[model samples]
Target: MQNPFSEEQVRQLNEIGKLPPTEQQAKLQAMFSTFNEEQIKFLQNQQKAVQEQGGQCPFCMIVEGKIPSQKIYEDDQVIAVLDINPATRGHTLVMPKKHYALTAQMPDGELAHLFMVVNNLAKHLFETMKAEGTNIFLANGAAAGQRAPHVFVHVIPRYNGDGVNFEWEGKKAEDEELAKIREQILKEGFEIKEEVEEEPEEIIEHEFEMSERIP
Candidate 1:
């Protein structure tokens, strides 16, 4: 069976179709910088297998003890585990204990609690694991590379010369275009709260990147 492409992944491939042949090749090469030919093929096969498994949300099973994972943090509201497909060493995933199929579906309180855990965990990953930097990745939909419908925030600890790069091809926008986007974003974006008293979350410190937790 063919791998089920995310909507965003499909859009990216379709955009590549608009490029000149030479440009298309270059863009394609850059987008796949982390994987070699064999790895890419293997990923495709693995993705197909995952898709064929009937769209199960693996993270939910892990939370329920049906799937074993090295959990390093948990609270009444959120849980943290090592990612199966990590971008770098000490990569961790923070998810809400309550199910939210997408980030947009998450309540403000749960969202705040989820990121609070992510922030604290990222700090520990760097200080204890010797990671120099970190990347916090969240996806709302398939276009953002969300494989599972259950929302997860990836906290990837970065070291110097780590091969992971999430850069996209840059493009210039006119001042008019930029101004309109800025206005629209400011108009519709989140309103900052002066005080959001979130519940204190629990943290469990563990010492390894193995057991479906890290790179």
Candidate 2:
């Protein structure tokens, strides 16, 4: 795509860019001072628009019907929707109806129930779509590639040559190292009121399975 700015605007921008680092901020302030009230308001509105897009929670809007989505499953606690950007044909995303900013923030009851819904959807996708395999993944934080503020459980159907890859270092640690890690998790003393049933490990390997704040 071509540059959006007009000739004069482009020239002014280039001139501003060429200014010394120490002078750039003052130059920018003076340049904006030339803009009239309407221009100033327009710039402010543009800034706010960017902030809203970056900071606004999208899944919350979808649950509220403010954003249109084709929901495949929904109940009192959680909802599953077709992923707008799919890794494969039958890719889906399951998330809580109640927005939890982080997966760790979700109550144990909600977390257990959410995966049950996820499990059912994955089965339907694998059977109906005849996927060779499947991957259940959660990108927990920004470092893990989480784009939205909302927690999303990605149910991706995998074929033999799907070209999707999650390259891990597969780094190994000592048994003593692993035992110490286990000890810290046990130290936290967090236990659910009732234990939740776990799914078979034969199917998709549920990613993001880890304890908080590695010891």
Candidate 3:
């Protein structure tokens, strides 16, 4: 099949070359390196359109029936669908009902609900598909392999001898830097911590119940 990505995009992919195989990240550095001025402009235009018409966001279009997708699971707050180009057997994507390019942009309650759906799907895939393990992935920016601006989480199933891997080097953190980062996080305030207080325990249980319904 002809590459779905444009020539510039392909060049960009080549520039990045093969990413650390263990990371399982898309070879985006090379892809972006190939993006010409025109392609970059096109992407910018699409993003502007998304911002102007919240209801018309690409992911929202899929969710609102304006666009078509291979759906696996869905509810009021989120949707799980088959990836058009799956990396592994039973690879799926989980997206929020709202259109947010990055997870950081999503409301705490919405992000919580989205992850709740992801957790449920992970359990279902392991039990029904008999997967050995699973990888939950999120890419934030173009540099991070985010092709579409819409925020979606990838739920990739792995089995013994499946050949999929997710290895990355973790940098050692200096004690002073770590302490400074922790202090900053404490000062900025966090939403997840606060939202958990308002949500009832049964709601969490219901999320798990919904997971059991997925095949």
TM-score of 3: 0.59
Q: Can you give the lDDT of residue 16 in candidate 1?
A: 77
**Candidate 1: worst 10 consecutive residues by lDDT?**
204-213
lDDT of 2 by residue, 7-91 (tens): 8866886797797633543444556635554544544454346546765457877877788988877766777888998999889
* Candidate 1 TM-score, true structure as reference: 0.63
Please list the C-alpha lDDT of all candidates, in the order they appear. 0.70, 0.69, 0.69
Q: lDDT tens string, model 3, 111-198? A: 8878878888888887778998999998876668786757899999889888776878999999999999999978967664344423
Residue-level lDDT of model 1, residues 1-215, one tens digit each, is 45455577667767976986445544444556443445456444554456458654577777776788878787677788988778897788989865555554455677877886788788888878899999999876555566665789999999889999988998989999999989987895767643455565444443433222244
Clashing pairs in 1: 8-143, 82-213
Indicate the TM-score of model 2: 0.59
Candidate 2 Cα deviation (angstroms), residue 103? 2.2
The root-mean-square deviation over C-alpha atoms between each candidate and the true structure, in angstroms, is: 12.6, 15.8, 11.5
lDDT, model 1, position 178: 97
Candidate 2 Cα outliers beyond 4 Å, as residue runs: 1-55, 179-215
CA lDDT of 136 in candidate 1?
91
Clashing pairs in 3: 8-34, 12-30, 12-31, 12-34, 13-30, 13-31, 16-30, 22-167
**Pairs with backbone N, CA or C atoms under 3 Å apart (clashes), candidate 2:** none
